[model samples]
Target: MSEQNASAAVNIDITRIMEMIPHRYPILLVDRILEFVPNERAVGLKNVTFNEPHFQGHFPRFPVMPGVLIVEAMAQTAAIMVVQTLGKEAEGKLVYFMTIDEARFRKPVVPGDSLHIHVQKTKQRGPVWKFKGEAMVGDTLCAEAEFSAMIMDN
Candidate 1:
């Protein structure tokens, strides 16, 4: 971990997350970063709610958060890991999806559940970053995946 990252804040609120990445409103999935170990690992959080627009169409009878959105949450968490690690130098950069492997949605995520997104850095080279992420609600595993992304100036 870089010196700056080593001393990085562990708790990151939504306002701070918004400054890190270019996401807002309905599309911004992560609500807070619960744990950040700079370049090594990060745990992001999203409070699933019925008011979300996707739930309206995902299922009328039994609303469920889409699996694809879970993966997007993981991607965003990984991006924050990079941004937090590099600090201000990473401000104007964006992380783009390169690949997603071994993705699996084990259970449905519903409203009233707090989705815990845990991601760890598996590898990094230049602007490329690889990670393994898992989404969970309480003790149940909701999703898991291995993914890669590239950080580029926007």
Candidate 2:
């Protein structure tokens, strides 16, 4: 992490986030980053809607957001934390999920709900980082998980 990001409050706009992470439409889970604490934590936002492609097969009629997607969103949020912590040096770097522990789905996430994803760094070693993540829709916890990932330059 750079000294500027370490001492200063960190925040990244959509354009910069796009340049740092390679995920795109339908797959790019985070819409924008709300806050970053360098190597500590990051908050991200995702506006869920009925128009999302996953709704087609995830459920044809009832249309409840899949649990896996919620977990995926949390993972993406972690990626943002990791990337920003590395001071955007992760450009062209690939982050692969190594493990997910204590994952729990507390409630059903649905269309039209805005997801607030929060991820905090717990530890880091070499290229591996561990994080705790949670997904909430309006104050109610929808899902959460503790996961690890390995960062490698692509």
* Tens digit per residue, CA lDDT, model 1, 53-135: 99899998999999999999999999988998899999869999999999999999999999999999999999999999999
How many clashes in each candidate? 0, 0
Worst 10 residues of 2 by lDDT: 3-12
Winning candidate number (lDDT): 1
How well is each residue in 22-131 modelled by candidate 2, as lDDT tens digits? 88887888887887887888888888899999899878887888888888888887887787777747876888999999999998888888998888899999999999
For candidate 2, the lDDT comes to 0.84
Off by over 4 Å in 1: 1-9
Error of 2 at 81 (Å): 1.3
List of clashing residue pairs for candidate 1: none
Report lDDT (Cα) of residue 36, candidate 2: 80
